[model samples]
Target: MSNEHITTGQAPKPVGLYPHARRVGNLLFLSGVGPRVAGSGPNDSAVPGLVLDHNGNFKEFDFEAQVHSVFQNVKAILEASGSKWENLVDVTVFLVNMKRDFHTFNRIYAAYFKDNQPCRTTVEVNALPTPIAIELKCIAVIE
Candidate 1:
């Protein structure tokens, strides 16, 4: 089968040169979705509830906001790929600081995935490409 690249104006532009998602047959695979608001670049003040100084140090940060925004971004990509939130079959989460943010992220994740409980794995990393605290890579079924 062929692959279809997906893009949408509802979600933030990807940090790199990639479409929001790619579909092969019935499977839709999303690129890593971050919390930066739609129409915002990798830098600037796109990230919700976060402020950085001239040197890129966190002036104010809110993990909850990032978590929620990432979910919204993922949902947007899914819909754009001819899928929906309920069609999700797998989710891999990237967290910059699991120790400081896992509990909050878990709570928000539960609220969002309460019904469509897809298989999920979360890992802590040194950092993300941007200033956001959380990112999500997802897979969903078109049917």
Candidate 2:
């Protein structure tokens, strides 16, 4: 089956050289999304923001805020591919400090994925971009 790349205006632009999402057959693969804003438009500024704080290094990062931002980013990609969160099959959550932020992460995560909780895996890592706490990548099916 042929594959297609998906992009949307509603989410933050990819920080590096990568498509937001790609579809092959009935599966859609989404890249990890962070809290940076692509821009208001083509000529606007790209704003890079924080998502967590470790000691004084990751200061200004907000757990809930970044989680919501990641969801919005995923939503934009999914919608572009004629899918939604309900179509998600698996999700991988990466955290800088799982012990410190697991509870807060679950509380905020529940809001976005209320009913059909997809298969998920959460892992603690040593660090993230600019010391951010969390980053999420997912896979979903197109109807």
Candidate 3:
């Protein structure tokens, strides 16, 4: 089978020059999906996951809310590819502050992946392209 590039309006339009996800054979690879809201157009500013300061550090960050938005965006991309959360096989998460936020993120992650939990690796990064504290890049398989 040939590769299929996927895009969806339900999630925020990608800021970079890439599709939301791509399929090669039965496996699908997703781009790093952030916690931005789907803006009206490509150039419109996506609503950030939570409040932030000039330095892009959290002033009053809501980890749960940010996690929820990121997961929702991931869900949208999966649905667009004829898959769902259950089909997710792996995920790589980026967190701006692992020491401060990992526990909350892990709790929320547990709620989302109550079963069929995919293998995950979370890392602390200096920053994300957006002001959010979390992002997810995932992989799934479609029948």
Candidate 4:
């Protein structure tokens, strides 16, 4: 098995120290993704109104839209690696307010995962970048 780093223009480029995703053998390791659009922060052209809360407060979080953006980022990386959601083998979700938004999270999550439920673990975290409620990272095996 060879190690390959996958890059895609469709998704937001990682900021600090990570690749979008990496492939080792038949398995792909995707990094945690937040609701960030390309060239939108500390990078190139800024995306106005992309920030959920202007004051850096968690109370004004846009949960649904953030979740959707996370999945869209995931989709872009997965497709770039020649894989899809159906190939997902495992997923781990991190939430800043799990108790408050578990139901809404489930509903949004179900739309993407569907009946092909991969092994998953969800955890409540104290905080996340931009104070967003949710962040997701997954692993998939390409057949």
**Estimated TM-score per prediction?**
0.96, 0.81, 0.89, 0.84
Q: What is the C-alpha RMSD of each candidate to the true structure, in Å?
A: 1.0, 4.1, 2.3, 2.8
lDDT of candidate 1 vs native? 0.89
Pairs clashing within candidate 4: none
Predicted candidate 4 versus true structure: per-residue lDDT over 1-143, tens digit per residue: 87998877777767667788999999999988766674344353222224534554433446787778878878888998989978989989998888887889899888887778999999999976544567788999877
In candidate 4, where is summed lDDT lowest over 10 consecutive residues? 41-50
For residue 90, what is the lDDT in candidate 4? 91
Per-residue alpha-carbon lDDT of model 3 for 23-109, expressed as tens digits? 999999999988788643444435454666777565676777778888888999999899888999999999999999999998888
Report lDDT per candidate: 0.89, 0.74, 0.84, 0.76
Instruction: Report residue 17 deviation for candidate 3 (angstroms).
Output: 0.1
How would the candidate models be sorted by lDDT, starting from the highest?
1, 3, 4, 2
Judge candidate 2 against the unseen true structure and give its global Cα lDDT, from 0 to 1.
Answer: 0.74
Clash pairs of candidate 2? 53-58
Q: Which sections of candidate 2 miss by over 4 Å?
A: 38-59
